[model samples]
Target: MDAVAKEIEGLTFNMLTFNVVNDKITQGFANRIIQIIEKHNIDQVIVIADEVEEPAQFLLNLASAARSICISQTCASYWGGEPLFLGAHELSWAPGMFERKMDKLFIDNRLFLEFLDTEDIKMLRERLPKIDKKIWFASTCLIHGLYGLNYENNGCVVQSCISDGNEVERGLISITHSSRQDERFKSLVKLREYHFIPYPALACYIEY
Candidate 1:
């Protein structure tokens, strides 16, 4: 924590990505982030890593301070671009399928639904029920049961992977350097287990 004060010598930071919903961002802390960003003359910032409903206000505050900000729709990364919304929703059709259940977990959040554009809403409503059933069944099935999908139940909700959510068909996808990737000639696709489907109970914010 002391590092924030030491390294922050009015540097021109390219980004300041915070997990908005995380408890670390109390009112006083939020104000301090604003102060730090402003003091550093940050160019732009990436939105909170995953959905933490409470920190929405803090994110908005940072956006106001930075020149621009972009939140991942699911986990969309940008190399360079104007601020935009990210809507990353994934699902599978078959019951007992792991991927399908993961998608439903993301959709149930009220904050997620609110940010989703019209197209996103349309896509989710059509796929929700089928996706939910599979995961629900899997939760009970001892052989196939992967366990609960929440922090309390020893399972966590996976947020982003390939954006399409077609892991079996598409292979693993890791989101790197978001928008403006075309110009930077960067690889947006990555392969990593750090962000995988069927979340675990432990939630550690190690740089993905």
Candidate 2:
């Protein structure tokens, strides 16, 4: 984990993702994120909810977790809460001319999420003229490509996975490796890497 984070921090455009949905290495997926923030000395973070099973819960935690969290102000309104930074100029790109060959939504309904609609994205584009784009920052979210999960220079992509084990049994980590270019995995590979693998493999994130 230390190595992974370091490699990411070294990026020309530094970035990383968290499967708040699942921790690919130890258990306590929730606390593990908090630990990562402290361990890596991360100052700000973005939390993206892949599914809506618990948006409020995640947001509440996110609110408490970051130094100050910034979300799509529109999504905050849709969820009925005011975010610290409600205006994200980047939200402007409402997705266009998708080249994906699968799914009818790819052609017609590109907006994609419950709270994220094309209209909000369009509105964001309108306000973008005022926001400068020269800043470099780290983002942690479950959001798809529009959120910038892929590291183009290295041709590296961020992936996530979850386990289906019973409540009593610790679930295995689900590792979905895909091209950083693909929005969410069109397909996935489930490995017991999270709970089953040796933690040393995660030399990328942890210190010896």
Over 4 Å off in model 1, which ranges? 19-24, 47-53, 72-194, 197-208
Q: What overall lDDT, based on C-alpha atoms, would model 2 receive against the true structure?
A: 0.28
lDDT of 2 by residue, 1-208 (tens): 4545566553432122453332122324445555555555454444332223333343344434444232221122342342222222233222110111111111001112323333543343333222222111111221222332222222222322111222212111111112322222211112112223222221221111
Candidate 2 residue 83 Cα shift, in angstroms, is 20
> What overall lDDT goes with each candidate model?
0.33, 0.28
Q: Which candidate has the top score in TM-score?
A: 1
Q: After best superposition, candidate 2 residue 76: deviation in angstroms?
A: 19
Once fitted onto the true fold, the runs of candidate 2 whose alpha carbons sit more than 4 angstroms away are 1-16, 20-32, 42-115, 133-208
lDDT by residue for model 1 (7-83), tens: 75756655565444322345676677678777777654443443322354554465457644433333323313322
Q: Each candidate's TM vs. the true structure?
A: 0.37, 0.26
Which 10-residue window in model 2 sums to the lowest lDDT?
101-110
